[model samples]
Target: MRGRGHRAGRAARKRRQKQESVVQSVSLCHELQYVRLMKFLHQRGFTSTLLQPALFTDTGRGLQAVKSIKPGQLLISLPESCLLTTSTVLDSYLGHYIKSWKPRPSPLLALCVFLVCERHLGEASDWFPYIDVLPAAYTCPAYFTDDVVAVLPSGARRRASEQREAVRELHSLNQNFFRSLQPLLSQPVDEVLTCEALRWAWCSVNTRSVFMSHPSNDSLSGQDVYALAPFLDLLNHRPDVQVKASFNDVTRCYEIRSVSGTLRYQQAFINYGSHDTQRLMLEYGFVAPCNPNSVVYVDADLLCDVLRGDRSLDQKIKFLKENNFLHNLTVSSEGAGWRLMTALRLLSLPQTLYHLWKAVLLGQVLCEEREEWSVQTAKTLCQRLLQDSHTALDKITNLLRQCDQPVREQLDVVESLRQEERCILGSCLELLEGPPRQPDELLSCAPDVDAVS
Candidate 1:
C-alpha cells in the first residue's frame, strides 16, 4: 500500500514537470520567432536598438525598452520599403491582376488580400519572418462568440454586432474579387481567401496598422492610409503616453519619437489617442485600466425611459432628436457630459418656457425648479445604470470562472469595461447626492471609486 501511494506521488510530480516543460518550450519558440523577425527588419534598414519584443503580464505582447530612452529621442523607425501598403500590393506578383481588374478593389481590400496570400506562402514568402510573429487569432469582438458578445454593455454589444456584420458583408461583397485572383494564385484563391481568413486579415489591418499616407496608387480606389509597420506595430497603446509619430520624408522612414522617456526594462507604449474602454474593446480588443477618458454612455432607450414621466414626452423627444441631443449622453469622472446635461434640461423644462429650449442648449439656465428636476432625472437614471452595472459584473464573474484562455481574455476585457462604467457611475452618483446643482452646473472632477463591492 505504501509503495502504491509513493508511485502515485511520483506520477503527479512527473505531470507537473511535463506541463512546465511545455510552457517553457512555447515561450522559447516565441523568442526565437521574435529574434528572426528582428533580424529580418534589420536587413531591410529598419532597426530598434532600445526595444525588444516581450510578453508583458498586463498587456500580453509588447515592445520592452532594453535601455532607458530619453525624451524627444527617435525610438524606432521603419523604412518606406518595409511598409506593407496598397503600393506594396501593387508591386507584388498580384500587380497586373489588380491593375487591369474592372471595378478596382478598395485600398483596404488590396492590403487584406496581400496579408492572406502571403500567409499561405509559408517561408517561401519574403515577409514570412514577420508573418510568423503575427497573432494566430485576434480577440476583437468580430471574432467573439454570440454568447460572449451578448455579455457586453449595451452600447458595445450593438457596435460589436454591426462590426461583425460589416466584416461578413465585406467578405460577401468581394467574392468576385477573391474569385478574380484564382488564375494568378499558386493554389485556389477561395480556399486561401476565405471568410475566416479575410476576418483575420481585416482585424490585423484594423488593430496593428499605423496611419500611413503615400502617393496614391492608381490600381486602387479610396484613401491609402493603412501601413503595416513590422516592428513598429508591436508598440502597445497607453492613453497617457506622449509620443510623436510621422512619416519623415527626409529620412524616408516612419519615425516614432518619445516625448516622455521610457525606463529600462519597462514596456514601451504609444498613445492610440484618448479612446475610452468602449472604443478600446470594440476596435482594439483590450481595456485600459483606469482610463481617465472612460465614460458611461446613456443610450437613447435609457434616455427615453428617463423622460417617459414628463407630460411633454413626445414633444421633448422630437426636439432633442432634431437638435442632435438625442444620443451621445454620457457621464464621466468629471460629472455629467454637456450633452447629458442639455438633454436633461430639455426634459425638465416647464411647459410655459418651451421656447427657451434652444436657449437652454446654449447654456442658459431657466430656473431653480427646472435645475432641481434635471438633477433628479440624472440621479434616477444613474441609479438604474448603476444597478445594471452591478448585474453585468456578476454575470462576468460567473463567466470568467467557467471559461478558458482566449474566451477568458474576451470576458476579462468586457469585465474591465463594466468595472470602469461602475466607477464612472459612482463618480456621477456621488455628485448628484450633493446639493441641487444648476442645469448647466458642471462639478469638479473626482477620484474614481469602484462601487461594485
Candidate 2:
C-alpha cells in the first residue's frame, strides 16, 4: 500500500510540472508579441518606450534647430516629449492591471489588435495615434506614408511585410478605441443617466456630428450611440448641423434639421471649384439624402465651362482630394448646385426615416433661402466645411425645432441664436419674391443675421 501511494504521488508531480511548462511557454509567446507591437508603435511615432529611450530622444544639434516638427518628421525623429498624452495614461493603466510585465505580454496589445484588424487605411491614424491626423478626420500629409517606409533599414528586402504588419497594428489600435467606448454606448440609459456630469454629449464621428438629446433630467435618452463610418465621414460638412427632439406631427418619430444648411449650400457653391469640381458636379448629380424628392439643381454656365476644356482647377483639386483636404471655390453667385447636393447626400446618417424627412425639409428651406440671398447680395457665401461656432448655431436651431414644446417654447430656447447681431434675415429678404409678412416672420422664417444683434 505504501509503495502504491508513492507511485501516485510521482504521477501527480509530473502532471503539475507539465502544466507549468505550458503556462511558461504561453507567457513567453505573449511577451514577444507585445514587444513587437511596441516597436512598431515606436517606429511609427507612437510611444517612446522607456525600455529603449535612445530610439526616440533627439541628440544632435540639427534636431534642436527644428523645435516644432510635422507629424511625419516627429515619427522619424522618435522624440519622447512630443508624443500625445494619451499614450502615457494608457501605459500606466496597463501596468497596474498587468503585473510582472517584464516577461509577461500586455493584454491591451491583443485587445487593440483584435479591434483594429478590420479598420481601413483611413482609420489607421486614430488607432495608432502615433500616426498624424486620421484619414477620416483630416488629410494626413502625403509624405507621412513615405516617411514610414523610409524608417526601415535601407534596402530592407521585407519592406512590404513591414508595412503590412504596421498597418495591421494601426488598425488594431483604432478598433480598441471604439471598443472602449462601446460599453458606454451599450449601457442602459437609466444606468447611464445615473451620471449626469455632461452638459452635452457631442459625438464627432465620420463627418457627422451627432448631438444627443437630453431630457429634463439631463440624461441620455434611448437613442443608440452612432459609430463613425468611413464613407460618411469623407463627405463635405458644415458646423450648422443640429437636431430638435420633437416628434413631427406629420410623422411620429423624432425629427432633425440642418439649421444652417441653406448658408452651408451657399458657401459650398462659392468654394466649388470652377474647373473639375464643376465637371464632377455635372457628371455626378448632387444627391441630397435629406431631400427625398431630390430637387434637381445644377449650374449650367459652370458645366458649359468645364465642357469647353477649362481644366485649370483639375490638378489642384485632385491634389486636395488625394490628401483629403477641403477647399472653397464658388461657381456662381447663387451657389454650386452639385456641390451642395453631393455634400448633403454623402452624409450617411443612421437616424430613422422620420429624421430624414426633417433633414429634407431643412435642406429645401435652406437651399431656397441661400439662393435668394446669394442672388440679392451678388456675393458668394462659402466656408471650408469646418466644425465651428457657425455650425453649432445651425445645430442649435435644429434641436429647438425637435423639441416637444410649442414653437414659442422652442423659440425661447433658441432666442440666443436670434439674439445674434448678423443680418441673416436681411440677406434672405433680398432673395424673397416679395417683402416678408412681418419683420418677426422674416426673422423666424427667413431670419436676418443682424436682427439678433
Candidate 3:
C-alpha cells in the first residue's frame, strides 16, 4: 500500500511538472517576443515545432525546438528581446538615429551584439549600431550557444533534461568561462564589447554543429522549432548576401561589387545562372589531374588558353608536369619528352567515352564551351557504343594499352569509376558487362580480388 501510494505521488508530481512547464513556456514565449517572431516567420512560409520551454531557461523561462524552413532564407530575431525591461531608457537622439537608419538588419550581426550587450549595457542602452556589428559576424574572437534542448525526440527529452541538470551541477562551468576573460574585458569598453560579441558569435556557429545532427522527429519542443526555423531558412549565409549591399532603397542595394569576399559573390552569380551547371571543375570535390594527357575531364584547350595568355610557358608546363601527369613520376632521361607525350595520350579516354560521362555528370555538356560533350553527345556516343559492347570495349582496351604511361594508369580509375555505389558510371559499366546478379546472389559471392586488392 505504501509503494502504491508512492507511485501515485510520483505520477502526480510528473503531471504537475509538465503542466507547469507548459505554462512557463507560454509565458516566456511572450517575454522573448516568440509570438511576434513566429507570426513573421509564418508569413515567410516557416512552420514551428515549438519545443519544451524549461529546456530553454535553466530556471524555466526560455524555449527550444526545430523549425522547418526553405533553404537560403533569412530570419531576424527582433530587437524586442533585448529591450524588454528598459526600452524607455534610450536617448531621443539615439532612438531617432536608430529609427532613421534603414540598414537592412543582419540576424548574425544582431545576435552577436545581443549576446555581448546582455553582459554590459544595463537596462535600455544595449542597442548597438549594425555597422559595428558586421565585423564580428564575418570573422571572430569567437562566441558560443548550444542547441536548444527541444530538438531532441521525446524519448531523449528526459535524457536532455538530465544533461541540463548535469550542466547546472557544474555551477562553475559558465562562471569559469567568464572568469577567464576578466583580463580581456578590462580593456577599453568598446574593445571589450567587440571581443565579447565576437566570442559569443563564434560560439553560436559551434553550437549550430550540435543541433545540425538532429534527425527530424514528429513531435518537437517549442524552442527547438523556433531556433531552427530562423537559422536554416532565414539566417543562412550566402555569398550572394555578402555581394548585396544592405540599403533602404532597392536601387542602392547593388553596391555589392565593393564588398569583401567578391570571389564568393562571383561564384554565387555563376551558380544562379540558368545553366545550373555543376561546374565540377570548380567543385573542391576532386583533386586536379595528375596526368594531363590521361585525364580528359579537364578542358586542356581552355587551360592552355588561360596559361598562354597570362602565365609563362615554362611555369605552365611545370605546373602540368608537377600536378597532372604524376606527382611521383619516375621520368627516365632516355625517354626525353615521353612524360608529356604520355600525359597527352591519356587525354583520349576523356576525349571519347569519359567525355560523354562528364557532361551528364556535371549537367553542363550543353554549355557553350563544351556543347559537344552534353546529353546530345552522350546519345551520339551511346549510339556508337551500342553497335557492340564487346567492340567498344576492345577499342577502349586498345586505346588504354597504346596511350602511354599516363593513359595506362587510368585503368585503375576506370575500374574504380565502375563502382555501383559511387555514381551512375557504375550502372553504365554494368551494362557494358553482362547482366547484373540478383541481390541474394551478389551477396553470396566470395570476396573477390577486386574488392580486397
Q: Against the hidden reference, what TM-scores do the models get?
A: 0.88, 0.18, 0.22
- The window of 10 residues in a row where model 3 has the poorest summed lDDT is 1-10
- Across 1-453, the per-residue lDDT of candidate 2 in tens digits comes to 000001011111121111222211011112443355445555644432111211111100000111222222211222333222223323433333223223332332322222222122223424433221222211111111232222211222133245334434444433433344333343532333211111001101211222223222111112322222111111232122332223233532222232323221121101112222112211111111121111112222332232233233343334335533332322222234444332222121112222332443344333335334433322222221111225545554555466433332223212222222112323322433354223122211333332111
Prediction-by-prediction clash tally:
0, 41, 36
Q: By descending TM-score, how would the candidates be arranged? A: 1, 3, 2
**Candidate 1 TM-score versus the reference:** 0.88
Per-residue accuracy of model 3 over 1-453 as CA lDDT, tens digit each: 000001011111121112232222223234243455455445545443423222111112222332332233221222222221112212322233223333422223333333454435423332222112212221101110122222211222344355334434333233433333344344554454444454433333222211212223222211221121121211212223332222213331111122332221011110111110111111110111111221112224433432343323344345355545533221111221233233322222222233333333332222222222122222222233233333434444555555543233222222221121122323333442443223221111222221101
Candidate 1 lDDT over 1-453, as tens digits, reads 000001011111121111232211012225677788878887888766788776544555667788999999888888988888887888888888889887888888888889999998889899998788777767678888787888787888899999999889989998988888887678887789999999988888887888877676667888878888887887877788999998899998998999999988887889888887798778877766767888989888888776665566777678778888877789887788888988887776545556767777778765665566677778888888889889988887787788766676667667777877888999988988887653455322222221000
Displacement of residue 104 (Cα, Å) in model 3 is 8.3
In model 1, the runs with Cα more than 4 Å from the true position are: 1-30, 438-453
Q: Scored by CA lDDT, what does every candidate get?
A: 0.75, 0.25, 0.27
| TM-score top scorer | 1
